[model samples]
Target: MSCLEIMPKLGLTMTEGMLAKWHKSEGEKIEKGEILFEVETDKLTNEIEAKESGVVRKILVEEGETVKCLAPVAVIAGENEDISGLLKEAGVNGQEVAETKTEEKKSDNTAVEAGPKKVVVIGGGPGGYIAAIRAAQLGNKVTLIEKEELGGTCLNVGCIPTKTLLHSAELFSEIKDSRNLGIDVGEVSINWKNVQRRRKRVIKKLVSGVKGLLSYNKVNVINGFARMETENSLTVSKEGGKSEKIDFDSAIISTGSVPFAPLIPGIGLEGVIDSTGALELESLPETIVIIGGGVIGIEFASLFSSLGKKVTILEMLPFILPPIDRQISSMIADKLSKQGVSINTGCRVTSIEKGENGLKVDFTKGNDNLNVEAEKVLVAIGRRSNTEGLELEKIGVKTEKGRVCVDDYMRTNAGSIYAIGDCTGKIMLAHVASEQGVVAAENISGKNVKMDYKTVPSCVYTKPEIASTGLTEEQVKEKGIDYKVGIFPMGANGKAMISKEPDGIIKIIADKKTEEILGVHIMAPRATDLIGEAALALRLEATVDEVVTTIHAHPTINEAFKEAALAVQKRALNSVN
Candidate 1:
């Protein structure tokens, strides 16, 4: 048998590499460790050396084609060897010898002959796709099933598209206040159609990109709805009645979650909609009554209010963003109120009645029963896990409150099964789910891996974005942990002043005993990006003193973090008091 050679990957993260140029073509003689081809990864371009010295008999992939790592790029055989039969057996052209080398090096000690393990992952959301890719990387034959879009809620309707819309709204609000910065532009107007078009375009690109990634990772994507047949098998029904039963050695349930709309009278009314429907609305309503004051409700309120729509937000809770810091949420509420958004907390929707002009929504606020009329009513109460029909019971996997229960390694009760993302119900954030995906993959590959949620950051893409990581003040106080807080107003930041966009603050909480940072919170422009440093600080267990001593770039919003750290020691540089 002739030795076969293939392209090798240089890094762990590289999925595919571009064959920049082939130094040796078919029918060319080559020596061991000689330069055969140059490949380009995202990080760098390098040359692939021939592993075995022989005649280059065949080239599997063309020069310009970007082939996946470990795929056979060329073939080598001994002089005058019978290469035609080898090429045909390896699925190459008859005139060329094919490379039949495996990607992984086989160990000689193992005597057990085992079939390839199959892994089937339900749902193509962030968690499912990530799990699929990771499972494929671990030498498992993987299959991914999705009913609609590849990205599920986060990409199709929830996070990506909504953020795009929120960005547009934020820009519109910023342009409205451009006069304060001596940039005198005329009255600003919004094109809702164009805004929605941009959002749709972003979603389309992200969905396509996700598909490409899955394909590159050699994960078989089945566009269908999957139902559990047994603990180790599932049946997927395609769009045109095509169905297939797939048996797997291991399975991952990552069906994700959906918006939870309360069952109320007139919920099926023409104007009433949920978060998904709200995202699909082609035109903005002249007036809107948003039910619930949670993250989703407030986000839509902020966006629509900035778009010059009359928005009324009613929350069943006593306050909006109840989980966030009370002071920061209150400030945001005040700012939003000043922007003509009506926020009514401690209220519950009782009923809705259709009227001649619009829909009349009757709600109760405290002791007073109030009625409000609007063109549309949006219910943004919350989301529930998509765990129905998953047949977790058969698999011995447990679930609580519509969330799959998993250990730190993201493994379900069944040893071979795992769960991640919203389905696991640990951290609902998308990035957290992606991290869990990696951890699950590593654990499955016999590596000791556990998910770390300590420094997971959360972001709300409102006009002034709110990004936070680690513990909140209320959480620290509830735990009876001795913590000190340092807060710096954005008004003191030179960058905020120059941009005339000082409307938020940064708060840092540190453990008093150890002086290590416990949490970091910020509400300002680009707070999403600025929170990363704080997250790193918490992850590294950096002390408040360390942050204070570190020099931040001058005239930047990031200075607020350093100043907040200084305030922890009662030595702030820009304190007005």
Candidate 2:
């Protein structure tokens, strides 16, 4: 079916409007309700969305052109439809002009072209997979190369598996408290094998879904390790001596990261394992010693301790989760202590040795020797960029501190090559990698973009999940910025009582003069999900009053945000100021 576009009438007296901007260009395919164009009326600019799905065959009135109300402005028709008669009826000679403009759009890369160039992406992590899909959408022939599996570390061994196990642990923890929730019956036990099986299934399903997404985007996938032969050339050597060479117009590297294992005596012992080895545990250990106090360390501590293990964490820093707010970290530490998890901060591990029955870890706390024996030891110190085989040096790609160097545009020193995700070492989170991938792809496809980290949220999957975005109180103090903080406890939240999770609080920091929300930190149930609102408020430069005035859902954890906002001005409703 063919549909003719017309200048929409805004008010009864309105007679004309100026075509402001076209969201979809001529020959662009559009779906129903997609913003097709904007019109400037006497009152305001209004976006006109497509009423039906079709291809934009002709743009009768060019942008900035004035057209009378109810007059034809464009023509939409089914795919490959002849719109010559419609153009003739509208008294418009736009076919030739539209064709020429479309020819220009094809070269620009913002629009789809008939002859798509090649885009070879190394690594099939979140960043690489997303970039592959994006480039494919931009009418580029995208080929994604991976050595082991799609979804990279995040899906195979990192984020997905960790979170899945965390959820299982959380459930078991809840079951252990079933009596308090008005449940009389229960003998709860940690079925570690079943939990591992479920986590594996979830990961397998997601990896398969990622494959489907790549397939849907028409991206070709190669199962092999890829190495840069030159700036524009790559060689992939598959198993059984199979190898192939690929050339590309532009390339992206998102090889992700590997667990950083430092040089320590007996670090390579059978019982000493990194984060990946922790996930592949054959059976639950009765006693465990975790060798770091960062995000990875705390998370594993939470997991094993919840599942009935005597988990001990050793940190060389003054506080666990050093990147988090000091107050929040202390509160979480206290909570973990109450849960039987021993946290040793400012403690440095000197060496690991074979104990009489198990592994022994020797450490120091302010020059005093300390030792802990455990059935298993996990080294969750940190992660480093995994560039073992890509041969970034082959193409003269610059790197800094063991990570590929890239500009704000995510482009490497080589103009045709770009790097994002863990390979660039920017924060090393999967979500961050995904966004950086989009930025890199957009820039390659003729879009002006830059990666921003100001409002990025960090989440830790502890018992009471910790999440924060924007500035921290310490940062404000260091900068000497006058700021005020508001805090609301979960003890007062009705949902918290119903859910039996009234063990945390929400804190909001804002500028004193401007009242703009500068940061939000939460240590509560579902804090990971609740932090999105705070991130958005900070991203939009919204004031505490704006968030306070916005009505939050009744009897929910998110209401803590509103009350916290109100408390910033000493006007909290549910809590006494």
Candidate 3:
């Protein structure tokens, strides 16, 4: 029998590895432990050596092709051994194929079998896709059912597409502001059609990538709407009147959430839309009124304002980003206002009416009723969990306030069933959902794993990105935990000064008794990347003293993190005392 060399899993988090380069080709003699291919994982890149002393009769995967772990990458056989049949069976060739057929056999066997545990995951959004991939990795048969697109709201209509447009908007704003650095250029203009086209292209690429990943992991992708049939089964209905009954030992409901539209007269007027509809960008309106001053609203406000549209934000709360530190939020609000964005806080949209030329919005500020006019109205209140279609009661899954309830292990009341992501009603972040998905999978695989929300980070992709991990100052004060605050402004950083884009701050909270870092918050350019150190610091229980002692690279933004720790003890190097 020929020996099949499969791509070995390098790490727990690594699902697929790229064949960076092929050292040996097909029909070549290879010795045992000889380097055959170099693979690149998320953490690192390494070479895979041959296990058997024989001729490399087939190379299943080629350079640049990212194959899943444990999937066949090559086959070795003796010189006289007949390997043509094996090669043909495995679809081996010199050129790399986008996807391999090995996973299909595995998925078919697992899905059709009754002995192995089966899992039907609803919705192919960020949460759903992650859960399906994790379930498949844990040796369970997974059928991921999606109604519209694989990535659901986040990838299809929400986060991914919106971010792409925001990137364009940001670029446009930057080009216009290039004169600040004495770099004068021609007049900057934006072709809205081209911007929309680029956004669509990005969305298409990401959606295809997600589909490929699911296929590589042996996760069966079903394009349909899924509703609960019973506690242990779900019925997926396709578009062409065809339906399949999926029997599952357990089910992970990751249907995610959708934008919640408020009830008001003329709210559904021609020019009025929700966040998802606004992302279409059919045409940029001259003026826009964005209701709700939350993350979604502010994000849209930033994008539209940057695009040279007159944008007004109506916020019912006293401040935007109410969950964040008031001091930090006020700074961001001031920055937005300086950019010509109007923010009206402590105001609620009572009603909207369509005028002859534009839309009229009637809002109330306490006892005063105010009227505003805009070309388009956008409702950005919040999202509601997608728990409507799936009859949870029939399946014995308990839900509260339109959200599925799961324990620390991500398991629902229905013993074998699990719930994750937005449906679980925990932290609604994509990374948090992905982590929960893995925890659910591990639990199903007989491994004792639990979801850790304490270390989960939150990020807002605004002008100066905001990222935070761990407890907030309010929580610390409320709990009466003796904590020391350390803060460092970006203006003092050498890199920030050189870039001429320094308008942010980094704050660290540490336990006064133990000196252990309890939380870290940052607002700066590429603050998302800088938060990793803080996250690791909190995860490893690194104390403020340790962080301060660690030598950071000079003239870098990361030095701010180290300096902030030094500021905790009133020993900052750059701070003017």
User: Top model by TM-score, which number?
Assistant: 2
Clashes of 2: 0
- Candidate 2, residues 37-76: lDDT per residue as tens digits? 9987534889998877899988887654455677778889
- Per residue, candidate 3 scores C-alpha lDDT tens digits across 37-146 of 88875458898898988988877765544566777788899988987777675654322233342343254222111224788888888878988886675467888888
Which one wins by lDDT: 1 or 3?
Answer: 3
Pairs in clash, predicted candidate 3: none
Tell how far residue 230 is off in model 3, in angstroms: 2.0
Candidate 3 achieves a global lDDT of 0.81
- lDDT against the true structure, per candidate, is 0.81, 0.87, 0.81
Tens-digit per-residue lDDT, 1-577, candidate 1: 3665565678877776656568898888899889998886544779878888899988776553455566667778887888766666555431231221121213321111122468888888888888888767656688998988999889998888888888898888778988876789987899888988898899989999999999998999998888777777888888779989999877777888888868789888999999888888989999999998878898999989988999999898888987677777888898889989999999889998897658988999889999899999999998888888777776677889879999887777776778888887777778887888866764554444568889899887776788889999999999999989888999888998786668999999999988899998888878889999999998778999889888999988998899999988888999752
Clashes of each: 0, 0, 0
* Every model's TM-score: 0.80, 0.86, 0.81
lDDT of 1 at 316: 85
| Between candidates 2 and 3, the TM-score winner | 2
Q: After superposition, how far is residue 267 of candidate 3 from its true place, in Å?
A: 1.9
> Which prediction has more favorable lDDT, 2 or 3?
2
